[model samples]
Each structure stands twice: as C-alpha cells, then as structure tokens.
Target: MKRYIKSTIGLCLLSLLFISHKSVNDNTVIKLNSDEFNVLMGHQGSLEGSIKYGPNKGNGFSEKDNDIVYGFTDVNDKITWTVEVPETADYLVAIQYTGKEFQGQTPDCTVEIISNGKVLSTALRGLTQYNESRKVAGTRQWFDEVIPLKKGINTITFHFSEISSKQIKAAKEELDNGIPPKSSASIAVKDIALVRPKVWNAMKVRAKELKPDLSWMRDGKYGLFIHWSLFTYPLYGDKQAFETFEWGVNTFDVDVFADLVAETGASWVTFTTCHGMQMFPAPIKTLEKVLPGRTTERDLIADLAEALNKRDIKLLLYYNMSPRGELAAKLGIEENPDKWFQYLNDFAREVSLRYGKSIAGWGYIDSSFSAYVMNMPWEKYYRSLKAGNPDAVVAISSHWWAQYSPFNDLQTSDSGGSLNNPLDKKLFEEGGRYEGLQEHSSFVLDGSWFPKEPFNGIIRRDSNSKGGPTFSEQEYLDYFHKMAKANVPVTVNMLITQDVTRDQPFVNPKSLEFMKKVKIALGK
Candidate 1:
C-alpha cells in the first residue's frame, strides 16, 4: 500500500516544491506493503515495476526511488495484511492507484476479507492512469466501499490488475527500440479509515475458514511416509539429477502408490514434494521462476491427491526446506531470514492454493535441512500455507526442533524415543493440553529415508533401533499400542528399494504385510 503519492510532473514539481499535496490521510492507513506482518501472496519482488525514474522523468537518485508497488497481472498476485483493530466496526478502504489499461484491462480489483468471507470490489469507468511518464499524475481514486471488519485480527487481501498484456507487449516492442518497460501493472494503495457501516448484504465468498479438524489424523494412528524422489533412480552419464528426477516424477503411477498405501491400511501418506535437491514433482511456477528444471511437467501432486482421496486416504506433503542455495539466491533470498520466508511463503501459497482442497496436511520434513533454517517467519509462513486451504493442518517437525508451535497444527519429533517414545513433553510434564497442535512423530520402518547410494555404501552399522527400522515384531506393535494409548499420531517412513516393480515404486513386501496386521491390531 502506498504511504504517499506526490506529483512528479515537471511543472507541478517546481511550482509545488514548497506546498505539500500529500495524497491520502496517513494516520488512518494500514500498511499493506509493510514487511512487518504482510505476505505478497503470489507475487515476486524481482518483477516490480521499477519505472518511477524514467528518461527526463528524474535526474538523480532519491530515497523515494522505488516508491510504488506494481504487477498485479497474475491471477494469484495479491497483497494480504493481518490487521488488528480495537473493535468490530465498519471501515472504508480508500484505494489510490495508477494503472495503464488496454486490450480489455481496466481499473479493476477484487478485495477479499477472509475473516468475514466477503468481497467488496469495484472498477473505474475510465482509465485510471492518464499520464504515461508521470506516475503520480496518474494517481486516481478507486471505488470506495464500507467493509465490515471483525474485532481482533482480520486478514484483508487485494487481488487487482491495472496493466494488460497489450501494454506489456507494447512495452516489450518499445524495449527493442531504446525504451524501458514502463507499462507495468501496479497497485498504488492510499488509505483505510473508520466509517459507519450501513446494513450490508455483502455477497458470500468461497474462502475457507481456518478452523481445521484433524480428527481423521488423530483417529488414524498410523501414517505412511515415503521419500520417493529423483534419488529413487541412479544418474547415468551426462544426466543432471533434475533431468532424471523428472523421469522419476513422470514414471510415478498414482494408482500403484495408492494401492501400496492401501495395503498398509494407513489413513494418511506423507510424500516428499521437495527433498535433498529441491526437485518438485509438479509445475510450481514459483519454483520454475527461481530455477528452471527443478519442476516437472506433470502435475504429479494433483494426481496423487486424486488417487489418495478416491480411496479415503489423506495426502500429506513433506517439504524438505533448504532455501539458501543458488536456486533461492536467484529469488532475492539470501542469508536474510525475511528473504527466506518470503520465497518459502510464496511457494507455499501457490502449492496450497492449487491443492488445498484435495490435500490434508503438510510436514516440514524433520531437522533434515537444519543448516539453512534461518530464523523463519513462522506465523506468516503458516498463514501462506493456509492461503488456499484454511482447514489443512501443518507440522513444523524440522527447523528449530520445535516440539510445539502455535503457528502449526502438529508438534513432531523426527528423533523417536524408546518404549515411551514420541512423547509430547509439554502435555506429559507441564500437564498442558495439546489444543490445536497434536503430538506427532516419525521414524523409518527399516534402514534410512534414502538408500546407501548417497551414503557411498556407508550405513549405520550399530544395533540402535530406536527410530530406525530394526524393531522386532513385538516392538513394532508395542510402539503402535503405546502411541494409540497416548493418542499421538505417528508416521513410519518406508524405504523405496526399486522403482516400477509391478508398475509401482516397490515397498518391502514384509513391511506392507506388517502394517496390515498393525492396523488390525489397532482395531481401526
């Protein structure tokens, strides 16, 4: 959201140098673009319309150089704010924006309030941006609306479009002829003020509520997790890991995967979405933008969701985060925690929005990426993960080894304990109720998550079977019995030894047989 809009016209600038004509009332404004507690849902910082100082527009650099927010072209591109108000009341949102419209693009926007599930939006009759070179000269009032805000925290989202493909095409042609790309779409927000709301019969919205019910997760004590990724297949000569990874994704058969999980009688399955090398099985635009070839052409995630849902099984995603690599650096995310959070949040938004309804949960695959766990914006990241599907639960298993966090729905431990393992210390010791976040833990069924290929034939030769897959028959059942008694959700990771055995990623026949019995033992 814009804090102030100053006229940059040469004549207006010289004559009004002393007199101030600030655009809007700053006191009643809510900082929509502020990095404090806002998330640019589906937008990237690299594509911002940085045309504030064009040829003959400005002579020198100033503190207010990049003072405008731009590019609301993509349908998903939107700015969201979690605002805190004193009480429930009617408020007027006064939007100020300058946009160039062509090829059917107009001064149009969709204002969404997820809190109340309402949309109060409008479109200007004429073109909002009349001045091409002068940005502030194009500043005009967007339609006003008295929106009713709830008390406490309210999430307001703005999805808008000011520039069209025609303008972008023209700008591209201009770029070839010694001109810059200035016909970029933008969001020039002004202010929000308190107002008396008239009786509003606002149209209902499809935004889901954040009240997630994980009764299925709690009841279905056993969850099957598989680390099936590009690593599943060996790399051949001159083959990049990603290229082979795409083959793995394309070769994956969702029906076979569903049958494998069904054989175990597991109600939920945690499949790796991004792992060791950060390869995604679906065409996530955000991932593609950061690094080409990291995403697959097939929508494997969606297919998996369909197959699992058909069998009454929940699809949970495992996000192995390491957002400090070359891929992330290209996304303007370096060592900075905020930068890391921004990229991750954008990624989560796209994934969540796409598969929110079909998917049930997300797990930050245990302290697996500890080296790059920059002080993440947990709250904002959580919010973005629920952007499309509010009812989906999350498990912050990794990162800080955080057992329980208010930001997520499940508290997890990758390091399983002994007979009395997978414990929620807060509930057991502090006598605290695990209200929103439930106690959850994961351990491998046998060997390790990845085969000894990366281990270079070096494996843990010890007899330590606490969390490893060396448990005796009794130990396995006993573990589940204890977990069921304590009412904690536990995930058992299975090692995929071969790909496309019987047209499916082959799991150990014994583990599948054992899990079927385990399900019967639990009497679920």
Candidate 2:
C-alpha cells in the first residue's frame, strides 16, 4: 500500500511536467548522423560527437570490451574521435561517459572542438573514481558532462599523450618509498557521448546564473523505514505449535523488498532487526541457543547492506531495546526486563562491530523499560555507536529516551488521532484539518510497524493508524512543499501490500501520473 501510494504520487508528478511542456516538443528536432547528432532549436542548434579510443597494445591500453587503458602522456600518439556538427550551439556542449575504476590518478586528457579549421573550444577531461583512496574496488560507474559546441562542420579530438619513461620511473619510486602511486587509472571508460538538448534548455544557464542553496539535507529530512522480521517467515501465523508468533529465515523476500525500497527514492532506509512477534538471528549466545530454527542459513543484514550501498542509500539499524522477544518466552526470561535489556545491549554491540560502516544510525525500538534504566545504558550505547562512526545519528523510542534526552535526532511522537498542524490557530482550535499534518512519520519506532489487517485493537491504538488519511498526488506535493517552506521535515509512510505491488487495481497507472505531478510541484 505504501509502495503503491509512493509510485502513484511519483508518476502523477511526472505526468504534470510532461503535460505542461507538451507543446515544447514541437519546437525541437533531433537527428543522428554517423559520428554526430544534432538538436535543432528555434533560434540555435546543438551538435554532439562520439569519443574514439586509442589502439590498446601500443601504450599498454588493451582492446578489451570495457578496459580503460591509461599511462599515456607523450607526444606523436593521439586517440581521436571526429564528428560533423552544425554551428550555433557553441555556448552549450557536454561530454558524458559510463566508467568504473578504483583510483583516479590517471593524467587528464584534453578535448579540442574544431570547426572550419578554427578551434571552437578546448577543454580538459579529468579522471574520477569511486571508493577509498588507499583501497579501491572494481565497481561499474557512470558520469556525464556538458560543453560548448560551435556551428558548421565540427571535429572533436581526444588526444591521449603517452607518459615519458622518466615519469614512469618517478611513479615507481613514489610507490617503492612506501608512498601511494601518483599515477593510477581511476576508472575504465565504457562509452562517451556529447549531448545538446534544444528547447527550454535553460538548466545549465540558470544554474550558472543563480546560486541556489543545496545544503538542507546535511541533516537528513526524509528516509525509508522497513518493518520486516521473522514474522514474515510464515505469513503472520503458519506454525505447528503456534504457541509463540512464527519466525524463520524464509519469511522475507529480501532482495525483492530491497529493490522496492530503492524505487521510492529514499535517501535512508531502516529495517527492523527484530519485532515483538519474531526472534532474529541476533548475536546473543543464550538467545541464539534458545531460539528455535535460528539457522545460520542466510545473512539478511549483509544482503540489506549491499543492496542499500548499491543505490547509495543510508542504512539505519532498527533494534528493539527491551522485551525478551518472542523467543524469550521459551527461554524463561520473558518477564525479566533487566536481562532482556542486557541482551539487547549486547545485540546492539555486535551490530555496531559487524555492520558499523553500512549503518548510518541506530533507531532504538522503544520497548517497555524503567525510566532511569532506559536513559542510563541506552544513552551510553548510542554514544558507543557514535564512537564507531562519528557521523552516525541516533534515535530512541522509549518514554525517557524520547522526552528527557539529547541522545535522539528525531522525537518519536505517537499521537493517537489524525495528523494535525498545531500551528494553525483557528483550525487547530476547532479540531479542523490543516495542511502538512496529513503526512505521518515513516521513521522506525515503536508501534510504527505496519500492522497486518485484522490488526488487533491494541496494535492500531492510534485512531490515525486505522483508516488513516489518503492523499492524492497534489496533496503529496502540497504537503512536501509546505514542509519545505516551514523548515519542517517529515517522512511520509505510503503503505503498500503484496496484492498491490505498485501495479494494483487494474495496474496502478495513477501512481506514475501522480509522481510526475509531485515532481513538478517540488521543482525537483
């Protein structure tokens, strides 16, 4: 339900943008030539060219399908790709490529655009790479750039100059002296292209003209919170004993769910390590030994970390701070809150040690605990996580943790009724609805888990959780903008079910349409 709602909202925003610019399509024409492309505008034209690679064997550059051969900075040898483009769009030109390399120490290459035997533009292309400086990985990457293009027949040349033997000796010396190599191929360049879009192509110009502030999210605004656990192992109730809530490693479709969460464009995602109804394979010796069917079959947390990292999504570990957990009932520690807290703290320690790099923060599931104890060790635990990762954020759910503590980044507000704007004087007093309050928190917290229908009355204690407000695309856009304007950030939870799966009710065509509309309103 949340997924469908989010998709619908995204598509609606997209449709609105396309509809508004429907007539603009008539103002431009695109033509592809052998080695070049053209975008004709009403008053100006744009031209693009393909990038040619050098011979692999000569300069240690291989002819492999996707190898980016470097070590070239010499004269007499140049790798060139030529193109013929009409004049006029010289002020706007761009070069783009998809590459994957570990390091970026390769010497930069220069690009020359010649039109009618005169140099129209000359620019330098630099090497860019991903991963840590000392240690790098072989990952696929993509990047694009914009450059100025001149009219009439044009020739674009990529000159790869080979490095002299003396420089190579120096590079070797730098490495031998326990220093890092100064010259390293940052990435493998897969393909390169030049692009020039005609019509309201004011994006580059506008960006250059107006300096917009883009640092709002230095502190995160919205994030994706996933509530999954052993409960998913058996569809809520599918066990022989059925004595305690069902839990097993087979409950979740981890990969599918990860992709689903990524599609929502969430900057951060939080997953429930364990819930009230299930016992996860937490690293507590006693707990792991006592828990039934707690197999070491699969590592869900590791899979989640990899998935989120692939999409550059921040990972937030959601853990229950209290509760013997469902398994604790069988272990005879179900009512012993003291040992339960100790076990939870140990579990948190293991998580911080194992997956600390992948985790951006810790979202403590506010369970039942004494006020003083909740504030005491839990606060220290949060501090310990910060010691592991200085940039990590922390959130707590219990009463003391929520109320009288600076150990939390977001205050978990479990308001029972509908979302309402407290700043609205008249509407707020009259109990009438106001804007911006319709969106609920998507953060991981106690009772924030999406409840299965036939949701016991205790689960949906808050009236808002039951038959909550349904929003249209416009509503989402409006709410998003209003929050931005008011300097308030919120995580909107758009519930989704397996039946819907983003294409529900005769294929949820409305979701995309709504997303399109929202994008326009947000001006994103």
TM-scores for the candidates: 0.54, 0.43
1-524: candidate 1 lDDT, tens digit per residue: 41222223343332233222344343323333222212221111112233222322211112122223443434334444445555676665534333344312443344332225445555533332221233222222323555566665555555433344443444444334433232333333322222233311120011113447877877898788777754543321333235567666666678887887887889998887677566788899988887787887899889989999999998888886654356555654443446556777898899999997898868544432222122344556778888888888887652112222235567654442233354434432221223345677677776566554432212221224222346788988988988878777888887663233354325655667788888889886
Model 1 residue 426 CA deviation (Å) reads 3.5
By summed lDDT, the worst window of 10 consecutive residues in model 2 runs over: 1-10
Q: lDDT (CA) for every model shown?
A: 0.53, 0.37
For model 2, the local distance difference test gives 0.37
Candidate 2 C-alpha error for residue 126, in Å: 60
List clashing residue pairs in candidate 1. 71-185
Q: Report backbone clashes per prediction.
A: 1, 53
Task: State the TM-score for model 1.
Answer: 0.54
The C-alpha stretches of model 1 lying farther than 4 A from their native spots are: 1-211, 234-243, 365-375, 398-405, 416-425, 428-436, 454-469, 501-505
Cα error of candidate 1 at position 325, Å: 2.4
